[model samples]
Target: MKRIVVLLAFALTSCSYFEKQVPNEQELLQKELKAINWNQVDEYPSIAECEKLTDATQRKQCFFEFLSSTIQQKLDTDTLSVLYPELDTIEVKITVNPDATLVFEPQFPQDSTAYDKKKIDSILRVRLTDLPKINPAIKRGIPVKTQFILPVIIRGE
Candidate 1:
């Protein structure tokens, strides 16, 4: 009985050790995209062609096309008109805290007359584990700070 119990424990431990390390879908997609160089253009692939891409790099590009479509659908004529009342552009700086916490601040428009001050602090929060899978700088419980500048252009309707 003692030998049988020990054998069972060893088997379970060994199985845990051999658990395969598989990359998540999103991480895989990011890797594939990073591996390739893509040229940016005003026009993008059609929905049907995008859905057909199987290669990691191609699929990533396709996904971007899908995202743009979704955004267009969400922003109707009225919302777009208000958000972009004139031919104006603004730049925003997003800062992420080093301690694995999220921190976002928007740089107000210089004129303060083009767009509203409405901005969300965190559009999406990725989990700690997820970060490691994408960016090498990210780790479990490690503090990191990052800054990003985004220019939003609004064309008059």
Candidate 2:
């Protein structure tokens, strides 16, 4: 009986020696969050056509190309080129929201007095509203908001 009691006590005490410390939920979450890179996304925002692409770089290129082409087409229908004859290109800041909404803001140069900023902004807002459905970027399997600047060329012809 004494040997059995001693063995049981030793086993119980030794069990703790081999056991590892389990982190709490908050600590685990913090550690996981820290491991993630906030600036880079696992997947780029894409349209239905770009979804078929498997390569990350190709997919990103496809998305940007599609967006730029679509924006170019939309702006072509407007008189932005005619209104601002000297403005051959405009840098547009595109925001892809997690909810799949897109916002476009035209970035003008410091000497932007040659162009009507309000009218150009209104034209961009109106023209860009007809974009096709876009999937938000993915970070660790979860959709995330992303913003990038795209330079769109304007053809005066």
Q: Pick the candidate with the highest TM-score.
A: 2
Clash count, candidate 1 = 2
Give the total clashing residue pairs for model 2.
0
lDDT (CA) per prediction: 0.45, 0.92
Q: 140 in model 2: Cα distance from truth in Å?
A: 1.6
TM-score, one value per model = 0.31, 0.87
* Candidate 1 lDDT by residue in tens digits, 1-157: 9999999999988998889989899999999888654433222222355546666467546644543343333333324346455524444463445443433344665787544556222221221112211111222334345455544443445
lDDT of 2 by residue, 20-80 (tens): 9888999999999999889999999999998998898999999999999999999998898
Looking at model 1, the pairs that clash are 98-143, 98-144
Cα shift from native, residue 14, model 2 (Å): 2.2
Local error of candidate 2 at residue 149 (angstroms): 0.5
Top candidate when judged by lDDT against the true structure: 2
